[model samples]
Target: MDVRTGLFYLFSVVLLFAAFRVITARNPVYAALYLVLTFFRASGIWLLLRAEFPAITLVLVYVGAVMVLFLFVVMMLDIDVDALRAGFWKHFPIAASVGALIALEMAAVLMGGFRASEEPRALPGVAAAAQAGVQFSNTKELGKLLYSEYLYPLEIAAVLLLVAIIAAIALTLRHRKDSKQFDPAQAVRVRASDRLQVIKVAPTRPAAPPAAPDTPAAETK
Candidate 1:
């Protein structure tokens, strides 16, 4: 077998194993680590496919940023493994049946195209340009395509992701009674005189000592 095919098979096997471990691992942290491994393998496969930009993005964005955050969150959470496993058997049959159904459906869909002879043709502009010696400068092409064709959808997706991030932060962050939180707007509006206050009080003189108690002879007299 060729080197590329050998590498592809190796990566595929590792990807599958890591994906399975992600679900089956008892420890949440281990599962997260396995997921990171899966991402790495997938990125490797993408690199082999000559999708360099997406491959690098997969590593930098998913493996570097998302998976690291996932690892941290998983480590922080106090997962109850026993509780998670308690209903495994009870749910196994239904889960298995659903999984089987999905597998069958996917198989049917994938196999459906096997008998088809014709493939869809690329657009004339794209095909003609590709046929010519014109090679796209990666970043420029990506920027042009993103801004021209997919701009609205990309912006909307970005805004949605930003909203989701804000929601997650709000949900996970708790306000403590001892924590001091300052609002910039409120601070900016405060006056120096309002922040400082002083009061003067007069001092009182000490009272004279009480007279000595009378003796018993003085009381008899």
Candidate 2:
């Protein structure tokens, strides 16, 4: 096989192994790390397909940002693995069925895409740009589609993500009576006079001097 084909098979094999490990690994941190390896392998495959935008985005967004956060969370958490796995056997049958259904659907979609009669066709804009000898960017086309046709759905998704973030923060937030915290509104409304106070009192009278020790002459006398 040629270099590209060999690399594709290598990446695909690693990707599948990493994905399997992600699901089967006993340690959450290891699972997260495996997931990161899976993402990197997927990005490599995307690069091989000449989809630079998606490959870079997959690495930068998922691996760099999301997976790092996930790994940190997994490592930091004090999880009871036994408690978590308590229902594994009970749920295994359903989970296996769902997994099988998903696998079948994906296989059908992929096989349909690989039909010999189906040929790749360029987009209208891309074809026009090609005829005019102008360079057309898939990223620019993606941006146009996101902003125009899918704008509302994109906005809805953004709002949903914002809600999810707020929910996560709220859920993990702890309130401690022992911890000192000031209300921002109260702090903003505070005045100098409220913060500072002066007390006035009558001056204390000086204490009388202590009597001197009896002189030596008095002792002699």
- What's the number of clashes in each of the models? 0, 0
**In candidate 1, residue 200 scores what lDDT?**
84
> Which structure among the candidates has the greatest lDDT?
2
Candidate 1 vs. true structure, TM-score = 0.65
Name the lDDT of candidate 2. Answer: 0.92
Alpha-carbon runs more than 4 Å astray in model 2: 128-136, 143-178, 182-221
Per-residue lDDT tens digits of candidate 2, residues 32-62? 9999999999999998986778999999999
* TM-score against native, each model: 0.65, 0.64
The residue-by-residue lDDT of candidate 1 on 90-161, one tens digit each, is 999999999999999999988855657857565555577688967634545677889999999999999999
C-alpha lDDT (0 to 100) for residue 218 of candidate 2:
94
Give the whole-model CA lDDT for all candidates, comma-separated. Answer: 0.87, 0.92
